[model samples]
Structure formats: C-alpha cells, structure tokens
Target: MGRILMKGNEAIGEAAIRAGCLNYFAYPITPQSEVAEYLSRRMPEVGGVFLQGESEVAVGYMIFGAAGCGARVFTTSSSPGISLMSEALSYISGAECPAVFVNIMRGGPGLGGILPSQADYFQATKGGGHGDYRLLVMAPAGVQEAVEMVMKAFPLAEKYRNPVMILGDGLIGQMMEPVEFPDELKSEPSNNDDWATSGMETRKSSRRNLVKSLFLDSEQLEAHNRVLKAKYDRMRREEVRYEPYNLEADYKALIVSYGTMSRVCRTAVDILKVEGFEVGMVRPQTLFPFPEKAIEEAVRRESCKVAVSIEMSMGQMVEDVERSVRGRCPVEWFGKSGGDVPTPEEVIDAVKSFVKELI
Candidate 1:
C-alpha cells in the first residue's frame, strides 16, 4: 500500500482495522473524536463492529465484554474520559483479558482544556483504578509512531493477556502526517480456545473456561496478584524501549523526555550542539516498563553532570527520572502543564541553566 497522508486519529482507526481488531467501542471526546468518527464509517466496510457507547464508562465495559469473548477490542479517549473508564480498566486487568486503549491527552485535573498536556503520565504508568495493576503504556512522538503503536498494541495485549495503552498528546492526534501501514504489523487474531470464554460450542470442547476477577478467598487473591506481578516483571525485562540522541557526544547535561515533548527536546539538543554546548536526550517509547536502564546508563556517562526530565506535565515523569538516575547526578524538571508546550528555545535555556550550575 502507498503512504497515506492522514490525521493521527483517522490513522489510528485504520491501523486498528489493519491489525485485525474487529470490535471497537468508544465515546466521542475532543482531540480524538475523529477516531470514532472515522471508524464509524470504515468499520462497517471492513465487516467489523463500531459502537458509540453512552459514556466513557460504558465504552470501557463494552471493550471488556468484547475482549472476554476472545475478540480483538480497543477504545480511544482523552484524559477525563480515561478517568471515567479506569474502573473498567482495573476489571479488565484483573480478568486478564487482552484489550487496547489509546489516550490522546488533554490538560487535566478537571476539564482543563482541549489542548495537549501530558499530565496523565502518573495515571498511566502508575495505577489509575483501584488495586495494584499496570498498563503496558507506549507514548508516540508523532502520527507515524502513533499508528505503529496502535497496530503493535493488540499483539502485545494478547501476549500478556492485559490491556495496552497508547499515550499521545493532542498535537499527535490532530497533526497530519505521511504513514504507511506495514504488512509486517498485520496479523490474524490468535486462537483463544485455551482461556477465552468464547463458548465451548464454538471451540467444540468440554473444558469450560471461566473468566472472572473475583476472589473472595484472601490467599487465592494474593496468589492471583503474584501471578500478575510476574507478568509485569517479565515485561520490565523484555519490553523497555527508548531513543537516545547526541549520547555519542561528551554531553554535560542529559535531557529525558517522551512523546511530543521529546520532539521539542530533540530540536533543543541539536541547537545546543551547534552552539558548542553538548546536550543529550533519552526519549522513552514505553512509559511503564520505563527505559530505566537506558536513562541510568545515559546519566552515568562520564561527561554528563545532571539529568533533566523535560515533560509537558509539571513533574510527573521527573519522579521516574529521579528513580532511574538513582543519585548518579542531579535530577531536575522543567515544563508547562497548562496546555502550553515548552518550545525548543525554552528547553535549550533550561538545559543551559542546568549546565551552568554544574560548571
């Protein structure tokens, strides 16, 4: 297929279809309503199901229900909508059903604005719903990456039998870019006879599969949680992904960021190099199972004096950055959480200031 110039939201819908995800449930929300709008038309043509639920909460459960039936399912929403769906997310995780979620972030705490913000960092990487559970979160820097992540998310979710999240800011959802849906990413849904509640009649088996999260017995619940923890640990070891820029240079300061902010930081790193101030950046593609080892290595570089977490949120990701750096060097944060993206010049100044303090 030829490269198609597409809005990020539209591309996500198409990508989901291409990934063999036939069931989609969503509630319209800003910066990403286009995804629902696009799929409403496209899904029918593909002989897939498209449903607009009454609310985000309803949409979430719809995804859960479909996934429990061993179907490829997903949903998309912004921050507030995601919060409404968090409870269902917890249930899906507990039941160990494979599902995909895409959050096109908007400024938050309360209907903050329709503009982009990465404030949901803590919500995504940390637990959003009740109980201890984790979502395999991927943050994409551009439309192309977002499309790729959406395609890849389904298989990962199935592999782990857990939900996967694609985290993007409003800019990523609204921007138009050239992208081709790679054939390598296309695949048929895996057989679910082993665990799916799809029905014994369909699989022609006597073994009845029960899918539920309820465990009234304390010991059984603890054992279930331990099993979940093991999967997460395996993910931490196997799924960490990141991109390092200018790490080859003997940089004085290392900047860590992701998603749209990483794109800005990349520009800042380049400009600082031209100005004879060597700076490096590590952009994490996966938020959970974070690129901890990568950042630890970058900050430990001999010439690196400090690690700065540059984000669109106030300082959510900085906490992870500090944990990753583990006191190897000074760790700091600089960002605007009020729907304003920090520009390359602002990032350059922040890096320069950090470097000056080191000198």
Candidate 2:
C-alpha cells in the first residue's frame, strides 16, 4: 500500500497483522491502547484472534499459552503493565517459547504517569523478570522504525526460541507519522510442527512435545542456562544493530540515546552543527545486545573528548553507556523524569557544558 499518515500505536498494530501474527492478547493501557483498539477491528476481519484480557497478568499467561503451542503471539503494554507481566515473561523465557512483546513505555516507578518515558530501559535490557534470561529488545525511534521492528520481532523470536520486545516511548505510540506497510510481511503461518505442542495425532510422531520451565535436577537446570547463554552470545555477535549520525567527520563529543530521545538528540546535533560544534550520535536499534562496540569506536576518536547520554528517564540508559565507554572518557547523563521529555535546547546545553569542561 501507499504511504499514509498513521499514529505510531496504530501502525504497530497493523504491522503485527501484516507480520503474520494472528494470536494477539493484551489489555488496554494508555499510550498503547490504540494498538488493541485498532487490532480489535482488524483481526477478526482477517480471521485472526484478538483478545482483551481482564488484566495485564491474565494477558501474560494467555501469551505464554499461545506461544507454547507454537503460534506467533504477542502483547502490548506500558511500564506498569509490563511489571505485572514480569512473572509470565520469566516463565516464557525459561520455557524457550517464541513470543513478542511491545512496550510503549510511560513514566514510572509505580503508576508513575501516562506520558512518554524511557524509564524501562533497565527492566527491558536487563532482566525485568527473574532468572538468567534476556529479551531481544529493539528500540525504535519513530513510527516507521516501530513498524519494521514489529515485523522483524516474530521471526527473531522463532529463530532464537526466545522473547523479542519492540521498545518504544509514548511519543512513538501516540504521535502521527507517515508509513508504508511492507507487502512482503503479509501474514503467513509459520511451520512449528517440529517442536510445537501440536497433538500427537497432528504430529504423527511417537514422542510428544512438552513445553515447561521446570527442572527438578540442578545439573539439568544449569545445562539449560548454558544453552540460553549461548543463544544470547550469538545474538550479541550477530544481531547488534545501531545507526550513526553526523559521524562522517571527526566530532568532539558523542551522544548515546535511543527510542524517541534519539530523535531529539539528532535535532540537537543539527542545532550544534549550525553553530560550528561537531557532535555525533550512536542510536542503538537493539537495546539488549547493546551496540557497545559502536559506542567505543565513536568515542575512540581523539577529538571526541566525552560522551553523554540524553534520555527521558533519570539516567537509566546511562549505565549501559558508561559500561560501553569503559572509562575511556568521562561519561555523563542529562535527563528528565516523570513524563518530562528533554528538549533539544536542553541537550544542546548539556553538550556545551561537556565541551566547556573538555576545554
């Protein structure tokens, strides 16, 4: 189809439909409710299942059940709702079920606010639930990127037999943008007969597939953990994705940001460039297998004296930025919490301050 102006949440919902995801379970939550609202109308028309669970907790289990059966299933929620789904997320990971989750993050520690925020950075990239598990987290800065990530999430989940998350801020879910749905992503059912919990008669095999996370023996649990670790390592080596902006020439400072905050940082970079300051950015597309090496390369430049993380939370992502930098240079953070988005001018000011310190 041709390009059309669509809200970010609606675009993601459409993208999921186009990605062959027929099983969707979710509950309405601010900033991302449009996803459910759009799908409720579209899914049935396409002979897909759309369900609004009683609560986030219920939806999590529903997703677990669908994914265990080897169906391409997904759910969407904001920050607080994500917290409620943590238990199921842990179970899904341990069970190695292929599932996708979209988090249109809002400000929060607890029922923080309905406005856009990136406070879930730690929860998403790190372990939101318990156990040694990781989610292939994709952070999208715009609606178009969100569409692409949502389309990609399913295959990645199936390929790794792990959960994949499309991480976006409320701005990405609520704002309007022009997008064209890719015809290549039209829904096609994935073949899951190999390991999916299809009935014995359906599989026509002697053995039955059991999907569970429980391990009575400590050695078996350790072996399972090692297998999960290997998968994460493979993702780190092969799936780390990022975009570099204004890095063609030498820069004095590097800015690390993702999601909607990266867009703001790009504008700040433009503003600074106009005033004869060279500031570059590394916008991470994959949050879990963070583009650490990319950040290191950007700051390795002699002219790049410092790195700054501009975020919408109270410096949650800065930890990763710092770890990536690894004491190569001083890393600092500038952010606003509780739904306050940092303005381009504020980021510009932060960059100028860092430059002054370098001088």
Candidate 3:
C-alpha cells in the first residue's frame, strides 16, 4: 500500500485492527481520545467490536474479560486514565491474560496537564499497580514506530500470555507523519483455545479453564509467583531492544533517552557533533526489559566521561539510566515537565553544561 500522512493516534487504532484485534474497549482521555474515536468508526466496518465505557476502570475489566475468553482485545488512555486502570492491570497480569494497552502519556502527578510528558516511566517500567509483575512495555519514538509497536503488541501479549503496553507521549499521539500499513501484519484470529476460557465444549478434555488472580492458599500463590518470575527473567534475556545512534566509535559523553524525548536528544547529538563534540545516544525501544546492557556498554567507553538522561519529565527515566550505568561515569539529568517539551537547543545546552563540569 502507498504511504499516507496519518496522525499517530489514528495510525495506532488502525494498526490494532490490522493486527487481528477484534475487540476494543476504552474511555476517552485527552491526547489519546483519537484512538477511541477512530476505532469507533472503523471497528464496525471491520466487523469488530468497539466500546467507550463510562470509566477507564470499567473499560480495563472489559478488556480483561474479552481477553480471558480468547478474544484479541486492546484499549488506549492517557496518564490519569491509566492510573484508574492500574487495578485491573494488576488483575489482568495475575490472571496472565493477553491484552494490549496504549498509554499516550500526558503530564501528571495528579490531573497535572494535557500535554506530552514521560513522567510515567516509573509507573510503567516499575510496578504501576501491585505485586511483582511486569508489562512488556514498548516506547516508540515516532508515529511510524508507534504503528509498528501497536501491531506487534498483540502477538507479544499472546505469546507470553501477559499484558503488553505501548507507551508513547502526547507528541507522538498528536503528530502527523507518513506511514505505510504493512501487508505482513494483516489479520488472523489468535488460536487461544488451549489456554483461553472458551468453555467445556471447546476443550479437548473435560477440564474447565478458569482465569483468576486470587489464590487463597499461600503455598500455591508463591509457586505461581515463581513461575511468573521465571517468565519475566526469560523476557529480560530475550526481549531487550534498543537503538544506538553514533555509537560506532568513541564519544565524549552518552545521552540516554526514550520515546519522543529521544528524538529531541538525537537532534541535540547532531548539533553537538557539528560543534566538534562527539556524543552518542542509547534510545531504548523496550522499557520493561530495559536495554541495560546496551547503556552499560555505551557508557563503558573511555571517552564517555559522563552519561546524561534527557527526558520530558523530572528525572524519572534518569533513575533507570543510573541503574544501567552503575556509576561507571558521572550520571546527570536534564528535563522539562508539566506539558513542556525540552527543545534541541535546551538539550544541547544541558550537554554542554555536563561537558563543562567535566572540564
């Protein structure tokens, strides 16, 4: 198919449909409402189901129920709305249901603002709700990447029998870009009969499938947690993804960023390069199984005297960067929050400041 100029939110909605997601339930929230709106019109034409629930909390369980029944399902929301759905997310994780969630993040600690922010880094990569569970979190840098991530989320969720999330900022959801829908991602319903709650007749044996997170017996629950931990460990080993920019040779410093913020940092890196300062970047594509090893190696270069985290929020992702660098070099952070995006010039200045400090 030919490339078309598409808004990121609409592209994500279309990608979900193309990915064989037949059921969607979401409540409208700023910066991400377009996904719900776009799906509402398109879902019926595709012979799929679309619903705007009364609340984000309601929509989350709706996805859980549908996913449990072997239906491919997804939803999209902003930061506050994601907060409302966290309880259901925890339950869905515990039940090991395959569902996709898209969070087009806006500013927040409360009803903070309706603009792009990466403040949810800790909420997403760390534990948002409860328990020792992790969501396969993909943070895409641009509209095209967002579409690809949304398309891939369904299969990854089903493969692991766990929830997956597309973590994008408001800029990504609001921006327009040329995108092509790949024929390779076309639809076919997932074969989930083996583990799905598809009732007695669908089962090969007479055993009934039950999907629930609650296990009153402590021993059984502990064993289940061990199995879950093993799955997470496997994901860490096999699913870590990242993109390196200008890392082919030594650089004076390393800039670590993800999602939309990385795009800005990339521009800053270019600006620095022209000024005769070599700065490479580590842009994490997957946030949960964070590209720790990649970041570690990038900072390990002898020329990399400092590593800086450039984010849209006040140092949330910096924590992860610090964990990865592990004091190999000095770690620093530069950010803007509450709906404000840091410009390339601003990031360049921050990098210069770090360099000056080292000198």
- Ranking 1 against 3 by lDDT, winner: 1
Q: Candidate 3, residues 41-91: lDDT per residue as tens digits?
A: 999999999988999999989988998988889999999999999999999
User: Cα miss at 110, model 2 (Å)?
Assistant: 0.4
Query: How would you encode candidate 2's per-residue C-alpha lDDT over 147-237 as one tens digit per residue?
Result: 9999988888988999999899999999999998887756455677777897878878788798999999999999999999999999999
Which of candidates 1 and 2 reaches a greater TM-score? 1
Candidate 2 lDDT score at position 348 = 94
The full ranking of all candidates by lDDT, starting with the best, is: 1, 2, 3
Per-prediction tally of clashes:
0, 0, 0
Local accuracy by lDDT, each model: 0.94, 0.92, 0.91
lDDT of model 1 at position 113: 95
Q: What would the TM-scores of all predictions be?
A: 0.99, 0.98, 0.98
The ten-residue window of minimal lDDT in model 3 covers 185-194
Residue ranges of candidate 2 with Cα displaced over 4 Å = 186-189
Off by over 4 Å in 1: none
